[model samples]
Target chain A: MIRFEQVTKRYPGGREGLVDVSMQIGAGELVFVTGHSGAGKSTLLKLIALIERPTRGQVLVEGRNIGRLPRRAIPAHRRQIGMVFQDHKLLPERTVFENVALPLLIAGLRRRDIQRRVRAALDQVGLLDREQARPEMLSTGEQQRVGIARAVVGRPKLLIADEPTGNLDPALSLEIMLLFRRLNEVGVTMLIATHDIGLLDQLSGRRLMLDAGRLAADLGLH
Target chain B: MRIWLARHVQSALASLGRLWRQPLGTLLTVLVIGIALALPATLGVLVRNGEAVAGRWTSVRDFSVYLQPGLPVEQAGELAASLERRPLIAAVRLITADDALAELRTAGGFAGVIDALERNPLPHTLVVRPAADADDAAIAALADELRALPAVELVQLDSDWVARLDAMLAFARRAIWIAAALLVTAVIVIVGNTIRLDIQNQRAEIEVAKLLGATDAFVRRPFLYTGLWYGLAGGGVALLLLLAEQALLAGPAARLAALYGGSFEPLGLSRGGVAAVLGAALAAGLAGAWLAVARHLAAIQPRV
Candidate 1:
């Protein structure tokens, strides 16, 4: 459950990053946010994650206004959401298992429960076999899978991916999208921001398109 | 609760591993802190020994109240008897001028020279031993009171040298404390710098952890513990240095004191004092680590 209500984000250099963007996604829904590079898709996701507050208006998630969350409470808010990046963002020195277990570690979960959840998440992303392998040793697709496993290991209510497949090949991108679709079937709200429109058909659910800092179109869930 | 304990242990061991990975650097830092801690410790031992020596020498302290020339022996006896009646006076022995001259003549090996003198040159004197509780101020005050007597010409206190030594020792103790304070500050800077370098080296990992929702406390735990390790090691080294100094000096000091027919036992640090040193070092290390982390960790943010 994520909602942006007339949110306008202005950068420090007198540039508007997002303008009057208002949208809502129901619970357990998977949506794709498509726009050109720097078209405010990332900004929308950032606002939802509360990493960047709107210059005006409010971004609400799970019925609470995230923009208004106090500074001390930001960690709790962040723990409720899972984020993935295109670069995998894994600690290069850590093993795949350690990277996946990072979220559960931060949550102070029991080692046994963390081990089980981490193995299960790694299994879901088809990375159970490479638990001890470092991210640098893995292929780009495998690295993205590790990132996905990390993002979902904590079972966050809202999952945000910012151009997660931007560095992958077409086939790898499709496979990752299919994995995401499978995750959607098991109930995880997903918001993915990507410029790649070619692989949209395979995971087509809904597409919200942005143009020059404005929500230009909303292709409702089909 | 189990999870919390597990995380604490995990993080602590992880931090220990980090230090173990950089053994040479950590060892160098610890050595620097050890040298710094040892400087003050050495001076502290010096102050203690100085105090012991002063106490030993000052035990024979007394005041010589000399009577005016031509004073009668009966008058001197009366003066000594009155002096012994004072509260500060433990005992007073009266020596008439004639007796003083005769004793000096025997000990000075100048009997023929003293016999040629027309009159005895010495005056009647009262050797006043003070009470055990008489301090430097009290002794000086008693001398002042005695000098005011009609028959008393001069009051010579044998405790002045010891008093000067005591003053110098007290000043030295203060100087040592000042040195200790500066060295403590140096330790803090060393630890703080070490932690700062660590934070800089782990910048990427720190940013990633922040993104993954690691609290400031979690990120800070390892560095704090690492600083404490440095401090504890340094303190242990300082303790060894102090013990080594005492061990090396003990036999020689005893022999030298024996040559002078005095037993000089230089008391080294007590158990509580050693604990205090380690505890202070630990606290200083923790403070330094806290300052460094608080300053540097907040600047690292996950770049979205």
Candidate 2:
């Protein structure tokens, strides 16, 4: 569902984020982007999400060139892709239910639909009972699950995460990965960027490795 | 459409709830807006009252056309009849020389001294009342016309004080407009600053919302609503201030008018005036919030 053709990203002052990268992932694929710090993994996902445009070459999603998408169309384009972050990114003042309901609210869904979808998404994350609880009141794992629930509540076609398990312990990190695996099994495309090399065997997915902003390896893609 | 409306309602309530949690900050901001709005509104009310008083005082703008002393009473009566037929002259009454003499003898305390004169020295007079709708310029023009009439010695228009009052009231009205403009601008700035601070405080939330695919409109909804609420409350406070001023001044104003042998009622805001004040506040609030949002919202892209 995503393709990058010889894309290069160079930040201001000539620091290269990604150099001469070209890759493609088909529909419904759960892929992992791995590299050390300062690798181009996050930059690759950002190109797909249209957060930052490529400095050279084309980035396409679902056969559409998103590099040419107008600024006004960015939100709609983004709405089709769910995004999760390492920090959980939950509003501290809102309850778990409210946090999960945010994407639907931003989409301008009806109240009834919002409530129903929020509860269903929370149930998927096994946080149905904690819907009324605040984010700060939840455990670190639970908060991350809430973030996952929020990301998927809109039922986006592609889900991207930038080090989503970075803050969790090994066990909790595995749990989060399994949750992602469950979501992927249901036909949601997943692309996650992480530096945790040990968690790869627990979840079955293609791995694309980056080193010094270069595509060093593409394993399990024969 | 229904879903869109629901989202707006939700945003509005959420903003209101946030302000409610910080009662002191909200109250201080509202008070600042209220005082700004109240200054112009109060001045408007005072100007209206002044206009009301002037209306009562200038109701009758009459002129006296004094005929030559040697003019005959029949000619004066004819002149009064002719003057009454003019379009600008509402009514004309002929005061014959004999009637004037009789009136002076009965009303004036110098009756014996007047009878001591060999003959009556008073001239024939015509009291001409101008049309109620006649403006000052029109009345002056009609007065000049009367002065040019034959046998008329003098045309006296006792409306100079009324004209002065009219000019003063007009100046006051202009001043109110200027004051209202300046104060309205102040209110806009106040609301803009308040919304700016609010955006800064909610920076994290905004980033998250943007990351989650929120359109700029969605992120701006709550701040706009907050501005509207501030404007609404400020308008209410201004109305209350106007009412209080009316209450405090009504009795004294009436007493002062009574001393002048006239009744005065202190006028509060008319329905249109109230609507105007509220509308201005609401518009200013929305504009201020829009400006701040437009400038700052685009700068807060998700860094991740």
Poorest lDDT segment (10 consecutive residues) of candidate 1 chain A: A197-206
**Tens digit of per-residue lDDT, candidate 2, span A56-118:** 989999999999999888888989999998998999999999999989988988888999999
Candidate 2 chain B weakest lDDT stretch, 10 residues = B1-10
What docking class should model 1 receive? medium
RMSD of each: 3.7, 3.7
Score candidate 1 by TM-score against the native: 0.88
The DockQ leader among the candidates is: 2
User: Model 2 reaches what TM-score against the true structure?
Assistant: 0.88
Give the DockQ (2 decimals) of all models.
0.61, 0.69
**lDDT against the true structure, each candidate:** 0.88, 0.91
Candidate 2: global Cα-lDDT?
0.91
